[model samples]
Target chain A: MVLEATLRGIRLVGDRTLRIVERIGATVAFLVMTLVHSATSFRRFDLVIREIFFAGVQSLIIILVSGLFVGMVLGLQGHETLQNYGSEQSVGVLVALSLVRELGPVVAALLFASRAGSAITAEIGLMKATEQLSAMEMMAINPIARVVAPRFWGGVISMPLLAMLFSAMGIIGGFLVAVVLIGVDDGAFWSQMQAAVDFRHDIVNGIIKSLVFGVAVSAIATFEGYEAPPTAEGVSGATTRTVVSSSLAILALDLVLTAFMLKGWN
Target chain B: MERSTLNLWVGVFVLLGFFAFLVLAFKVGNLSAGGNGTTYTLIAHFDNIGQLKERAPVRSAGVLVGRVKSVRFDPVHYNAEVQMAIDTKFPFPKDTSASVLTSGILGEQYIGLDAGGDEKMLKDGDEIKLVQGAVVLERLIGQFLFNKAQDSGADKGAQK
Candidate 1:
């Protein structure tokens, strides 16, 4: 009996592994389908605009407030560490580069995943659970084009802009804390930052990173929702999966992108 | 939400994003003062470039006038060949000397251009004749140590 139980356990693990691989393959196909359908929304335009309002504008407050706090914390901590080395002057460069190169895109994307990503998943999941998607299909409407593609493109449009704004606000916050409160020289702060931060390498890479994250998060959200079983519990589970998988995807993609972009420096 | 209101909000959001982008580019990241407009390339060869790198500032009289465009090994001459993009506005005479320099003890290496009294301005692809290579701190320290050891030896001979 013990031997039989061990074999059962091995089978269970193997089943789950295959299930996960299946899900990943489905998600990639869904991504391609979404992209092909996206061209339809361009003619409509309003469909995409409405999604931009929901995904981009609605999430603005949380992104801005979090950006400010993160920057303030960076300034305070950077000051504490850099002063010991008598290089407090570089606090500006430190704060700016960190925010631009890594923090801005990463933190903003994580927040977007939890905020807008989960929302997209839940909204579509509920539509599926309530048979709204099936009704659209019956009405001769292509739900993928009419509903899903606009949301996908909306996220792609908004994520990079949001990340840029977050970095900008973070810089301002850093300036206020480091120069105004901590008494570091203002000129040194700005000048050193200007000298060190290259626009092409740091800022452009940040934009590209956010754009990629937007695509991943939106694709996962929409795919999970579209594939969700027509039940309340299924919808909820898919929503949870959207958050978990997209967060993991964002981090993994970031590592790959950073390694690829860093090759140009030398 | 009202139809006009939604459009207005998205418009504002897009505008704000581009505005933030401008701030990052111009105020924070040196976009305004970045290399643009017309520039002329000048070549200089050195024995040892030390840590001088591409995009290192080319300064004349402590003012940034250009940037290092490229650095390569000159196999024929057995040295380093550096190409610099000098701004067209601040033209240098053909006889100008270029030297590799450092800032603040151990800071980054850059090119220091000292102008000459020649009437002709440097043209694009012109070669700078006088070039000073980077100063290697290890070599300076080694020379100082050798001089001290030699002096001590001479003092020992005198005592004997």
Candidate 2:
């Protein structure tokens, strides 16, 4: 009897796992459909513009502050390490390289996912819980185009811009810490940075990484919100899931993209 | 926000982003969108390139005059051929000697030019005859260790 019970328990767990996987597959397919439909119906572009403002412009301040602090921290740490080897003057190169190549995109994406992505999820979840999505569906309008598509496009378009701003702020922050605070020669700092970082290699790759993360985080947020159980607790749960999952996705995508993009860069 | 106002802010935001991108590319990445302004090419041959790379600064009297345009190996001469683009404004003599130098102990390699007292200037497609190859640190360390071993061996032989 115990052996039969153990087998039954194993079968139940396997079935549950398959159901979760199937749900995820369905969500991804729906997201792709929404994206395609939104792309085709471009007449209501004002909605997209509004979303750009909400998702992109609204999150600018936090991204800048985080970028500035991160850059300063990197500069301080890089200075201490480089000073031991008498190569402190190359701190600018070190800071610019690290920010432009890795931290700028990854950190900015994490912040973006936390700030704007959560807001997106909450907004959509509330709309669903309050029956607005159902009302739109009853009225024969596709909620995906009217609701999710604009936000998705907004996130995608804004990601690279936010990432660029973050990196620029970071460069300036590093300058302040390395040059003004540490007394490294201003000329050496700028010159070495200019010489070492490559336009196509570092800058373009970083932008691409941010763009990919933007698509992923926004898709996850929208999917979770759209599919959340239509209840108060469900909305809050979706919001939490948006933040947690998007952050993890950003980190995971960053690793895969970095591995592909940064090959032969050394 | 009104549609017009929103459009304006969006425009401004995009402009700022583009401007920042330009700064990153041109200022930080050392890529210039402008044409190579009135430059001439000069070639130098080196025995070994070591860590020399294309776009390495070519400096004269501690001032940057040009950059390495390209680097290739001349199979016939069994040497590395480096093409440099010197700014026309900072022309040097035909007999100027170029030597590969390191910025610091663990820094990048660059070409340093010592201008000679020649009246004529180096023109386009001219080859700099006097060229010194890069100083490889590993080779230097190996030579130092070899010499120390030889000296110790000689001292032991004398004692015997």
Candidate 3:
């Protein structure tokens, strides 16, 4: 009986693994379809523009506040550490490098996933639960094109913008705490930052990172929502999954991208 | 939301995002063209570059006067060749010495120039003859430790 139970448990694990693999395949296929549809659907333009407002403008205040706090903390920490080495003036370099290279994209994406990503998943999941998706399908209107594509595109566009704003605010916040509050030289802060941070290498890579994250997060959110079971519990579960999975994906992708981008610096 | 209201918000959002992009590119990233004046090229060679990257600032007396354009290895001289672009506004003598310097303990490296007393002004394509390579901290620490060990050995011998 014990041997039989062990075989049964192994079978269950294998079956669960196959199901997960199948789900990932389906999600990727749906994402590809949504992308192709959105590429052509821009001619409608109205849907995309409206969705952009929802995705970007709605998230701005949170991004700004979080960015400011993060930057100020960086400044305080950077100043103290650098002062010990008689390099207090290099606070700007430290702040800018940390924000642009890592913190900016990663923090903004986590915030985005928690905020807009969750909302998209919930909205779509509810529509599915309420049979609105099926009703649209009955009318020969493609729900994926009409609903999911615009949101996917909107998210893709908004993520980089949000990250840029975050980094910009963070730099200013670092300046305030380091120079004004902590008494580091203002000239040294800005000058050292300008000297160290390169447009093509640091800033461009940050933008690219955010853009790729936007695609991944949005795709996962929409896929989870679309595939959710037609029930209230299913909708809530899908929303939770969107947040958890997207956050994990963001960090994983960040590591891979950083390895690729900074391959030569050493 | 109405299309017009949506359009307006989106327009504002795009404008803000664009402004942020400009700040990143020009202010933080320093992608802006050198103001009003043109830049001319100068070259220097170093024995080791030590994390010196392209677009690193070329400064003189704590003032940014130029930037490193490119870095290449000179197989013939067995050294690294660094090409720099100096803004025309900040002219220096041909005898100026250039060194790769770090901003802080672990900060990025930049080219620092010390003005020399010379009658001839540095012109386009001129080579800065005096060049100092990057100071690698690990090597310095290693040398310090080796010296300390030797000194301790000598002290022990003297006691014996």
DockQ winner: 1
> What is candidate 3's CAPRI-style docking category based on DockQ?
medium
In model 1, the clashing pairs are none
Worst 10 residues of 2 chain A by lDDT: A33-42
Let me know the DockQ for model 1. 0.75
lDDT (10s digit) by residue, model 3, range B1-160: 6778888889988888889889978888767746324899999999999999887888898888988899999999999999999999888998999999998777679999999999999999999999999998899999999999999999999999
Question: Which tens-of-lDDT digit does each residue in A1-266 have in candidate 2?
Answer: 99999999999999999987886686679778777878634677788878888888888889889889988998999999999988898899998999998888888888888899989988999999999999999999888988999889888888898888889888889999999988999999998898678787789999999899899888988988898888989989998988887888788888888888756445
Indicate the residue-level lDDT of A262 in model 1.
Answer: 84
Q: Report how far off residue A253 is in candidate 3 (Å).
A: 1.0
> What tens digits encode model 1's per-residue C-alpha lDDT throughout A150-196?
99999989999999999999999999999999999999999989877
**Candidate 3 C-alpha lDDT tens digits along A114-232:** 99999999999999988999999999988999999988998999999999999999999999999899889888888778767878789999999999899999999889998898889
Query: What is each model's TM-score for chain A?
Result: 0.95, 0.92, 0.94
lDDT score at residue A218, model 3, on the 0-100 scale:
92
State the lDDT of candidate 2 residue by residue for B81-107, as single tens digits: 999998888888989999999987777
Model 1 stretches astray by more than 4 angstroms: A1-21
